[model samples]
Target: MAASPELEGTESPAPRGPRELRLYGLNAVHAAFAKRPEAIRKLYLVQSRIPALQPLLAWCVAHRVGYRVVEEADLEKLSGSAHHEGVVADVLRAEPESLSTWLRDLPAGPQLAIWLDGVGNPHNLGAILRSAAHFGVAAVLLPKHSSLALSGAAARVAEGGAEHVPMVRLGRTDNALAQLRGAGFALAATVVAGGRDVFAADLPTRLVYVMGAEGEGMDRELARACDLQLSIPGTGAVESLNVAAATAVLLAAWRSRRPG
Candidate 1:
């Protein structure tokens, strides 16, 4: 190998911060129109394609929401992604709840929360957040090191849930679990190999359902910290269900068991 591509001076691109360019697709935009019109900053539509998006336009007009007719290129440029689906709406950043404040305000009754352990995928995180919101979860906690803030895809997938739910960034999983336990919430982790079936477990009134990352389940220490390790009953055909699907199942089961 004569001069195998010799290394030349190369500079890596600068790391980017949380997504500044937010694009809401058709479905997400429609949902915002119905639930959070005030959050929308600007709506961009193609003039020729106005007929297809009449409802959106009408809602914007009725709400006095500002909008503009722009070309497809402009939408792509603004979104910084090609999956905008012909409609893009710029929105203001939704206010986030402080982790300490959320925890401090817990009422003197049962509460439900979701803890995400090293869940790296934004789509999965977003889906789980949506499920958490649907079942009226009290809060969602994530280990600061392994989890990421809500992203554009997450915002889109979450629909309106991202705006409604509270997200907490705890620095360490073990410490977070300890705090939850002290607060009278039972910690339960979803495990694959050895754990009780979620459906049969007598879940406590206050619960923190800890979900692990894809492929790699919870770490041994974290699993041991859980008051119980639970598994979803499923056919043994697949390795394991996606984290998001499992989250929905567990959440639904938990919600059903709540006392009226």
Candidate 2:
């Protein structure tokens, strides 16, 4: 252990409202209701859209969730987005699971996780979470110093994927990597060069796909920690895929290789 390198990290932004996370749009609101209705502190709907939202309203009433039927403009103001689609909610805070918790809970089969250097943008984070859910990733671990916060915009972009996948905050990168290795997860770091082609390579069932900021790529130490360095083969003139696009591609590959 090289003095632990002063590992530091921050939890994803705390829920926006007083012990609540502001959520908007049909997909996000529906996910919140479906997966954790008890966490809904308050809900808002456009008056004209009530008929279309009756089922959700009924559930809110049955669950004793506070709600207000307001004009569409009110929803716009609340959500700060024109595409709110007439639904918004102040859902309760969701505490992120610890890295150790998820690792300990792994089932008997191979596990899949996305270990991110950091989420440079909320939309990118949302998109990655959506892909993670689609491919059944157990969790997404962010670097300790990551400034990325799962904001309302992120939830909207995720289209409910945020509710399905867990976001884990990591401490010293090396420490987490070591624990993962001990747990039998083979780390595969993504790189632009000097790596195996992800699609054709032999992938481990218990694996963590490592992705870093595009401009800097993975840090030297992090790259050295991986069991196999890999890349998504591409022939396009573009220099490289953005983090979200690359993640989706890699995840799809994982899904294809282990189809049910």
Candidate 3:
């Protein structure tokens, strides 16, 4: 396996924290309530926003989750975002299940999924997940070393999408890949160059799409582990699309080609 020139910059100065993560904004909070209300630890809202949040509040109260009325400044301080729309909640981490667990849970037939090899930006992670959910991707997998952050900002940027997608950590061991392949998935690596155009290529019924992180592209080893590689045919207007943009386009193509 070849070393990635991109791996050198993977180290970050910022520290990571425990599993509990704070989520802010009305859309994110409401979506969480709809999908996984039990995960909510606490809720904070501006008194002015209370009238609009009655149903949500009622649900929270009935479920025994605590809520407190706070000023806008307090809401801002609580969420670390001015765009929080006067709501924030501390919730359990939404980390997804292991590859084997996902495999065991399959209902039937063909499926589609994605793996993020070295994606760095949280907003991009959130946006990619939103696209994944839109195209019915079963889950989004990331390597243990990936710098992707499942943060409050990410959930906010995802609008209501954070509640729908499953995000998991599947490292570079290739164990997950082997299991997926044995289960009949054809893993396709997406590259900026040196592959057939995705628009014209044959796609498998069970597939996993691989994308490298921004600025540094995919790890060479991880890319080589895939069964095949494909590229999005683009004009020379720009060198490459951001990882999130490419992911959305590729997923759209996958959806468009189905036998619906």
TM-score of each: 0.78, 0.89, 0.88
Query: Which lDDT tens digits does candidate 2 get at residues 22-139?
Result: 8888888888888997888877787776787787789878988767877665666677778888887888767766778878887878789998885478788889988888889999
The per-candidate count of clashes, in order, stands at 0, 1, 0
**lDDT of every model, 2 decimals:** 0.73, 0.81, 0.80
Clashing residue pairs found in predicted model 1: none
Would you give me the overall lDDT of model 1?
A: 0.73
Query: Candidate 3 on 18-76: residue-level lDDT in tens?
Result: 77788888888888888988888878787788887898889887988877876676666
* Per-residue accuracy of model 1 over 33-132 as CA lDDT, tens digit each: 6666676666776567678778778877888876777666665565655666677776665544555667788787878888887787878977987887
User: Clash pairs of candidate 2?
Assistant: 9-144
lDDT, residue 173, candidate 2: 75
Alpha-carbon runs more than 4 Å astray in model 3: 1-17, 147-149
Predicted structure 3: lDDT = 0.80
